[model samples]
Target: MKKRFVVLVIAAFMLFVFGSMAEATVANKQIQVNYNNVKIVTNGKAVTLTADQEPFLLNGVTFVPLRAAGQALNSTVNWEASTKTVVITGNSNNNASNTDLLVQIAQKNQEIVALKAQVAALQAKLDDEDTDEDYDLDKIEDKLLDQYGELEDVKIDEIALKGDDDFVKVDVEVDLDDYKKEWKDLTEREIKNWVEDLVEEIQAKLNSNTVVDGMIYSTDDEDLVEFYKRGKNRLDVYIINNYKGVNASKVIDSLEGDRYSVEGIRFSIGELDYEEDKELVNVNFEAEAADVAERWDELNRIEISDAVDKIGKAIAGEFENEDVPVEAVRLYFYDEDNERLGSYRYNNN
Candidate 1:
């Protein structure tokens, strides 16, 4: 335990017990004190007051600086703001060890600050790299423009990115002008090969979770003849019907409205004919149920025949109000191996 009472008494005595001798020493705009008068000496030398430190004399008594005296006696003096007290403690024999500990703590604090700075810099660099790899949409557009812009058969018309590059929408035009090979000329094998090439090239440069929304083209003479899509592991090639003065968009729309040419069940345009004597047009198509695995072998022949007959009449009805020359439709239900599952013909005359 600290000798609190003794320390207080010594501090009080040093601050106040000079008996008016301090005032006697001050006169003529200067104060002088010698060894005979009240003075504190450390190591055989008297302590001199600086401009900020002075003795207080009042009513025949004197006050001195206790902090100076306390330090000279090998003590550590501090003010405790929380307790409102002046604490004076004697120096320990291990004072040098305490000073070394304080220095080490300061050095460790500097090292920690430096390490935090390095970590922050590294995290910022990582965030920038991630933005480039996962969020930048412009890079994908530039790549498509460079590769598909100058192809002979097709050209990239538009590129759009959505949802942090999670989806890539590419619109392309298949050139069929100058009486070139129309989309109807492309066989199933050709369609599959083209779609495979496109998907393979794009996915090779993208992450697995990304989806590509490629719209081949629309009707009304947009300089495109085909749009390809997939249905439950089935590759689809849609051939646009663009006979002169014949609007086929309405017909396909009608087919989709009746659940005939969408998703699992789809239809493709086949051979077409126009009967000049009868003023009637004949449309041909290959209707397929893509979801049926091993198609022809797995499906029932009776059901297939009935389905094709209904589909043909439904197609003919779609052209009833059109300005086309005639209203007629022919449907061919076929698979790769079977070659012909069923067929139907209709004429609304």
Candidate 2:
């Protein structure tokens, strides 16, 4: 116990000596510090010193406790040892260089944040515009029909009536089977007369004029006609100068075709019609490759192969099948000068 007490007393003496030495050094040495428009004080007294008056250094570093300097300048100083930086904060009482740097950083950050928000807003607006640009009316119409129900014979497919005008465009799909039973054994002349009589009856009901266009001649040389005959006998009747507000499909249903009407007719038709020019309605039939690449100056090797396969299938009359796959089909629309105006692609798988 005595030995332990001696050791403790010796340790205390060594600590006291070191503390005194530190205090002596602080009191003897003087430091000359220059601060921009800043004054230092200690214990409510102003501190003025020059670099030549007193120079104090500790462990290769100049040590100045900020509390003393800040009190003199009427400001506050904070030291962050982790980041090895000093923060000289200013208020109504004091102004400092460090305060200016912090202010500038905050303003720059705010600007950056605002710019980021603007970019995000612009991107969202562009997305909405792209969606609007891609809107397709044909697909919408198909979707609407699918949602409601499959259009049936004698049912009104669409009705567009102009309140101030006397003209309307009506689209109709007729069920040939309903009239085929009665005319199946009839001669071509009888069949023609029967069709004419039916059109007259429809015109009288609608209180409108009628004009019968030339009949479509079926060619035995075409394979499509043979394939069509293998399935069922069908006919398309294009009625012009009909009732202005009448539903074409409903009118067709009223007219007797086959002995009985079917549920709904399934067929594909091109979206083409006659346009009035001079004294007559010019009806021209034209078809071209669909989705032809603009860069194709002439048919490349790959494109030639594709064209051969497409033309071959078209000749075989299998191009109309929805399940028949084709690589590409481009349809081009041209004027009388043969200058291309627009193009479209059919990608049915």
Candidate 3:
């Protein structure tokens, strides 16, 4: 009988392992129990149980096969034929402290809720920062116009501001008639001084309102129009559009006294070199012999080096910020026929 019972258990185990094994049904007066599909998990991975050993739920109670429950709980399982009952024996630690597990699960749920709340608070803070950093173009333009409008003889037509850093780029448009009217009577030296003062004032005001690193001011008449740039080590200006250098000649002429003058001397920037370590400027001029020859002897004998240095410095001073130091000047003088009369190069060093 013991051997027969052992054989029955082995046969049942084989039937589970190889599901194609036929099942035996014997007529008995035992209560019928139905099984339904229910999943079992151990250490987070799914465990597939055969139909005979699978767990099921009925009448709000879960019923698991003896062997399946023993394996899941890591316990030893034994069957008793006298009472037809199965017993599971586990170590002291695995004696099924379900109440402690419930407490642990509740604590874990509370921790998850707290983590979700923290994430939501951080997201809200980020949203508030984004709102505070928004830019208002209309307000910026209004403030700019208000400050510049107070300057005499400057008719502000347009103002544009870009970027939100220590370096703000600005572009402005205005009418030049008023500015010319203010400077029309000033001598060349006085004009330069006035422009320098004006530039400082404008730069300060703009910087105070917002950090300004570069600016371009344009005029309808183009007089006193300035393109201003400030860099770590250099500042510069270029006369654009007038190939004959008419505007440049006028500016140079303004610097002359009664003894000698560069008036009516049409000139252009023949070459400009602005490499990383070298900065050079070259100017070419054409004038009537009568005008140039009036100081011919004096011109040749004059301090050419001093004259070039003064011219270079004056040109550099026009812009508010200078990054590169002007190092040299090359002058090419021509007569009425555009024939080169003389050429000279001066180095600051």
Q: What is the lDDT of residue 337 in candidate 2?
A: 39
Return whichever of 2 and 3 wins on lDDT. 3
What are the lDDT scores of the predictions, listed in order?
0.52, 0.34, 0.49
TM-scores of the candidates in the order shown? 0.32, 0.19, 0.25
> Candidate 3: what lDDT?
0.49
> How much does candidate 1 score in TM-score?
0.32
- Name every residue pair that clashes in candidate 3: 233-323, 234-322, 234-323, 234-324, 235-322, 235-323, 235-324
Q: Which ten residues in a row have the lowest lDDT in candidate 1?
A: 1-10
Q: Over the stretch 116-148, how does candidate 3's per-residue lDDT look in tens digits?
A: 999999999997765444344455567666655
lDDT of 2 by residue, 137-227 (tens): 3443354344422222222132121111122122223232343233222322233343444334323322243222222221221111100
Angstrom error of the Cα, residue 336, model 2: value is 54
Worst 10 residues of 3 by lDDT: 1-10
Q: Over 4 Å off in model 1, which ranges? A: 1-131, 150-163, 166-246, 253-310, 322-327, 335-339
Clashes of each: 1, 16, 7
